[model samples]
Target: MLTIDSLSHRLSSYLEPTQINRVKRAYYYAEQAHAGQYRRSGEAYITHPLAVANILASIHMDHQSLMAAMLHDVIEDTGIGKAAISHQFGEQVANIVDGVSKLAKIEYETQAEKQAKNFQKMAMAMARDLRVIVVKLSDRLHNMRTLGALPAEKKRRIAKETLEIYAPIAHRLGMNDWRIEFEDRGFAAMHPLRATRLHASLQQVRGNRKTLVEKIQAAIELRLQRESIDGLVIGREKHLFSIYNKMRSKHKSFKEIMDVYAFRIIVEDIDTCYRALGAIHNLYKPKPGEFKDYIAISKENGYQSLHTVIIGTQGVPIEVQIRTKEMDELASRGVAAHWLYKSSGDDDSASAGSYDRANRWIKRLLEIQQHTNSSVEFVENVKIDLFRDEVYVFTPKGEIIELPAGSTPVDFAYAVHTQVGNTCVACRINDRPAPLSQQLESGQKIKIISSEKSQPNPNWLNFVITAKARAAIRHYLKNQRHTESVELGKRMFMRALTNNNLQFDQLNHDQITGLLEKTTSESLDEMYESVGLGRITALTITSILLPDSDENRDGTGITPISIESPDSLLISFARCCRPIPGDPVVAHLSTGKGVVVHREPCKNVSDLRSKKESLSDISWSPNVTGEFLTIIRVEVKSERGIIASLATRIANTGTSIEGIQVDERDAENSVITLTVAVTSRVHLANVMRSIRNMRSVTSVGRPKT
Candidate 1:
C-alpha cells in the first residue's frame, strides 16, 4: 500500500528542491531495476525499498541516506551493479548501496558463518560511513515490521537475529525509536505467547489505572504551575519488552512491576530540570535509594534525566523522570535527533555534543575488530560489548571510564590502552592494594600499577569481562604459547637426538630442510614448536631425521619413559584419571597438550587407541615423587564430625585433603567424595584405608578408572 509518493512527501520537509529531485531519480532507478521481483508477501519489491526509505525519512535522515535506503538492494537483488548506480547517482550513493549489500559471490559453510561475514562487512562499511548502518537499520526495521509474510521458521530465525544483533546495535547508537520498536516486534514474533500475555496484561492495567494516571498527571501539572515553573507533564507506560524483561529478570508478577506506569516532566533548562525534581520530591515522598541524577553524569549513550520513584496517593508507587526538552528529545529519538538537526541545517553545539557522545562506542567497536580475527569471535565480542550494564569508574586523573558491570581492574587497564593492559601487574583501588581481578564499583578511583617485565597472565582470562580485555589477553597468551612451545619443541627434539646417539650439530642444512619438508613445517623453529605444542611427536620427527636402516619387527615402537625430573615441563599428568607412580599409565600425544600421561584404562586412551602410532610406552620412574590429585568416595553415617573424622584420618596418613563434595545423601548415610593430594597410588590407598577404619565411615574406595 505504501508508495514512493509517501516517501517523497516525508523527505520534502527538510530536503531542498535539488536534493528532492536526486532522491526521486534514485527511487525511479531502483524501481526499474527491481521491476519484476516480488517479496514473500507477493508485493512488488519496489514497495520494500520505498518503505525502508520512508522509515529513514521519518527520522529526518539526509537525502543521500534516504536515496541509499531506496536503492540498497539494487546491486544485490537485481542485475544492476555498483557501477550502474554510480553512473546513475553519485559515487557516494553507489558506495553506500554497495556497503549495505552482502557478499553474494562467496560460499559459506553454515548459515551462522554467512551471517557473521555479512555483519563483518557491514561493520567495516559502518566504520567508513555511519550512514550505512542507519540505512541498514531502516531496511531491517521495515523487514521486521512485515515479517509475518515469511515462513514460520524463517520468521523465528530472522526475529531472533534482529533481537540479538540489530536491536543491540540500535541501542548502542542511541537510536531509541528503532531499538524499542525492533525489540517489541521481534519479541512478538519470536515469543508470541509471552508477548500476547504481556500485551493483554498491559491493556488490563491501563484500563484499571486510566483515572489514576490522569489524576497524577493533573496533580503534577497543577503543582508545577503553582511553583511558577513551565513544564509539560506527560504520562507514559513502559515498553512491553522492558516490562517483560523486568518481570523475567526480577521474578516479579505483572502487578508487582510498579514502574510500569511512569511520568516524564519536560522543562526548559537544566536548572529547571533539577528544580522540577525537587518539586516532585517535595510533593510526594521519594523512595529511598531510588533517585539518580544522570544530568551530572549522563549514560554512555548520551541519555540524561533525573529518575525517581515516589509513593503517591493510596500507597501506589509512581516512577517519574525529569529532564529538559533537549534531554527528552534525545531520550525519545536518540541519534536520530542529530540527523534531524543536520537535515534542518541546525548546527547547534548541544546536538553535535550528543552525537559525539553516542559515537564513542562505535570507535571502541572498531578497536575490538582490530584485535579480533575470526568473524564468529568478532560478532560474539560485539554482542558482549553491546548488551552490558555499565559501571562508571574513575581513573587516577579523575576522568570517568565507563565499563561493563562486573568489569575488573584488568578490564579497565585494557580499556585504557592495550599496552597498559599487557604490562599491568597490579592495581590500587581506593588507595588500597587490590587484585587485578577485583570487580570495580562506580566512583572508585583506580590506579594501575605497571612493570615493564609484567606480562599478561593466562589466568586473567578467567575474570575479565570486557571484550577488549578478553581479546587482548587471548592474543597475548596465544603468542606466549607459540614462543614457549617452540622452545619446548627444540629441547624435546634435541633430547630425542641425544637418545638416538645423534648430535644436533651433525645435521646439515640440506638434511634440516628435508626434515622440515617431511614434517610439513616452514622452518626448524616451526617444527620444534609443533613438537612442543604436541602437534607432532618428537619421536616421529626424529625417525624422519634419522630413519632406521632395518624395518621394525617389534609391535609398533617403544619410546623411552622419563617422568623423574622435577622441572620437566613438557610432560604433564592428565587430571582425568590421575595416574600416579604405581598406577598403570600410558602416554598419549595430544595436539597442543604435550605428552599427557593418563591412566591405562582412561576413556580418552581407549578412544585414541585406534591410532597406534600416536601411543608411546611410558611409565613413572622409580623416583617419580610428587603430590597428585586422586578422588575417593567414602560412605559415612550422616552425623556431625563425620567429615572432621574423615579429614583427621586422611591427615593422620600424611595426605592432604584438597576438596570434598556430598555426592549423594539421605537421613541415614551420605556418600562423601574427597579429592586428596597424595604422592602415589600406594599413599592414596593407605589414606583410604585409614578413612575406612573410622567408625562413622562405612566404606571407602577410589573411583573407577
Candidate 2:
C-alpha cells in the first residue's frame, strides 16, 4: 500500500530516487531498532520518526537530513550506539544524529531550566551545523501535532517549551508558517479551555464574515489578474494566542480589536511584489505608518516581505504581506527554507551568508561557556541574545552595526573593534554628546572618541548592555584586579612603616604570609590583591598592625565605623531612597558618605546584596522616626506636562523633592516615576494622596516587600 517509490512520485522534484532509497533504508533500520516499543497512544513508536521524516519531506529536506531525521531518536531512545550508526551511515548522518542525541542527554532539575538549556544547546547545534535545529524543530512540530496523547501537565510543559524555545526560534529564523502553527497548537495544548472559548468565538465571527473575506480576496485577485501579475493569494485568521496576548496586554475586548484577518500574496520576484502592493493600495485605502519593506533589508533570520495594513470593506482593517516565492518559503520555514532551496537547485550564497553571520555568535557562546561555571550563567547570557530586539545603528562610514535593543554607544564601540571599546573615552551620537548609557535608537549614527590614555571605567559596567560589552568589562576588571592589587599592596606596606608597626621592605615573604593568614588570605599577593581590589579595607589591616594610632586616610575614614546610636547619631537617608512610612526601606553606610537610605527593593540595593555579600544584612528600623526620610515609587502614564503636574501635586502637600529621577532616558511607554522624600509618615501619606488625586496618576503605592 505504501512505498518509497510512491512517495518519490510526489516528491521527485525535490528528492531523487537514490535519495528516497537511502531514506527507506534508514527508516527500516529505525523501525527495527524501535521494534517492540510503543508510545503512550499505543501506536508503534517507529511511527513517530516516520511522521517527523514526512514533515521534513513536506518541507523538501535534502537526502542526508531526511535520513538523519528518520534515525534521530534511535540512539537516544532505542539503545542504538553512535559508533554503529557511524559505521553504517557516513559520518555526516551520524554527526547530525549524535548532535540530537547529545542535546537529548542534557537534562535539568526543572522544566524551565531544561527548556532554557535546550535552547542554549540548540543555538550551539545551529552554530555547528544549521541542519540540526531544522530537524529538531520538525520533531517538535510533529510532537505538537499529536500532543493530545500526552497528559495535561505534560501537554502544558511541552507547549510552554515550544512557546519559549521553538516558537522564538521560528520567529528568529523568519519561519512565519511554523511560528503561527506552533504557537496556535501550543496555545491550544497549554490553555485548552481558553483555546476552546476563543475558537468558538472566532467561529462565531467567521460565520458572519465568511462572505466578507471571500469578497475581499476576490477583489484583490481581480485587480492582480487585471495587472497580469503572477502571484498566489491566501487569506489567514490571526492566531488565537496572538489575539489573546494583544487583548490582555492592551486591555481591549476581542470585539474592539481589528486586523483579525490577513491576506498574503506570494509572487515570483521582488519587482512583482511591489507591483502587487501598488495594485492593492489602488483598490483599498492604505493605513498610514503601517507599511514595511523587509525585502530590502531582510531580518537577521533571513525573512523578507513587504507588509501593509489596509482599511478594507465594512471598515475592517486587513493586513497584507507581499513577497517572492523564495522569500515566502524562507518566511514560512526559516532555516528549513535553506534545505528546500538547495533541493530545488538554487544557489545558497544568501542562505550561507545568514548561516555565517549566525554562526559568528558560536565563538562568543564558547567564550561565555568557558567563563561560566554553571548552566544558570550560560542561560542568563544566552537569554540576552535570545529575546534581543535588534537596533540597527550606522558607523561613521555608513556601515550598519546591529546590536541588542537598549544597547549604548559603549556596545557600538565594542562592536566596531575591541581596541575602540578599550580606548573609548566618550561618544557623540548624531554629533551631539550623549551619555554613555544612552540607548541607541534605529537609524542613529554613532561616533566613538578614543584617547591614547583612555581605559575602561568601573561605571561602564552599568551602562554597557550587550553581552559582548558585559563580557569585555568583566575581562578587563579581572585583569585590572591583578595589576591594581600589587600597586595598592606596595603603597599599604610602605604606609605601615610610618605607624612604627612593621618594616615592610625589610620583612621576608613568610612574615607577610603571617599577616595575610589572619584574614584567611592565601598569600601575600592575595592580601595585597584584596586591598587593591577594595575587597579588604586597608584601614582594617592598619588597625591590626597599629592598634592605637589615629591615621589620616587618603579617602574615607580607615576605622571601620559601625551604625550604632551616637550622642547625636549622624543618620542620613539611604541612596536606595529617602524612606517614608509606606515605602519598603533599607540603609547603606559608607565610611565618609554616611548612612544612605534606599527603597528596599531598589535596583542598586538588590544588585549590591546579591553580588556583594557585605551589603546583605542592611535592613529597616522597626521603630518609626520623624527625622528619617522615605521614598515611594509611582508609575504614571505620560501626558502633556505631566511632570510639572506631578511636581505641583507633591508640592501642594509641602513635600520636598529630595531626588526626583525620571525614566526620561528610556524610549518605552513614558512612565514618569519620581522619588520624593518626606519628613514623617503623615508627610509621606499626604504626598501620596495629593499625587493620587491628580488626573495623570495611574498607580501609586509603596514598593513591594
lDDT against true structure, model 1: 0.81
For residues 1-705, what per-residue lDDT tens digits would candidate 1 score against the true structure? 677776677777788989988998888988888988998888888998888888887777888888898899888888688898898888998889998886332232347777777877877787777788888888889888898888888778778888898898888777887899999999999899999989998888788888889999999998899889999998977888988888899999888994445899999999999888888988999999888878888878777899999999888888899988878777766777788888777785556766786567777777777778787898888888889978899999999998988999999999889999999999999999999888998889999999997788777888999999988888877777777678767866776777667798999998888898999999888898898777887777777866772322221344545677323445677777867778787877678777788888888787777655477667677888668777898888888877887777778888888899995577888999888888877787788777877888888887776
The candidate that achieves the highest lDDT relative to the unseen native structure: 1
Tell me the TM-score of each prediction against the true structure. 0.82, 0.71
lDDT of 2 by residue, 1-705 (tens): 334455556557677778878888998899899999998889888888887777778878788888888899999987889899989888989988877776663433365566556656765677777778778888889889988788888788778767766787677666678888899999999889999999898888878878888998999999999999988999877779888888998998988764456899999988999999999999999999888777776666666789899998777888999988777667676667666766777767666555555566556666666545455657666667656767788998999887888899999998887779889989999989988889998789999999976777777877777777767767775566566545644554455454445576776776566678776887777776665444555656766666686764332222222222211122345544445544555544344322345666677776766654233123334554444445566777666788788888777777667666666534433545566655556777777888888765777876553
RMSD of each: 5.4, 11.2
- Give the residue spans of candidate 2 off by over 4 A: 1-13, 105-119, 258-260, 348-350, 360-374, 404-411, 418-426, 436-440, 450-467, 470-705
TM-score of the candidate numbered 1?
0.82
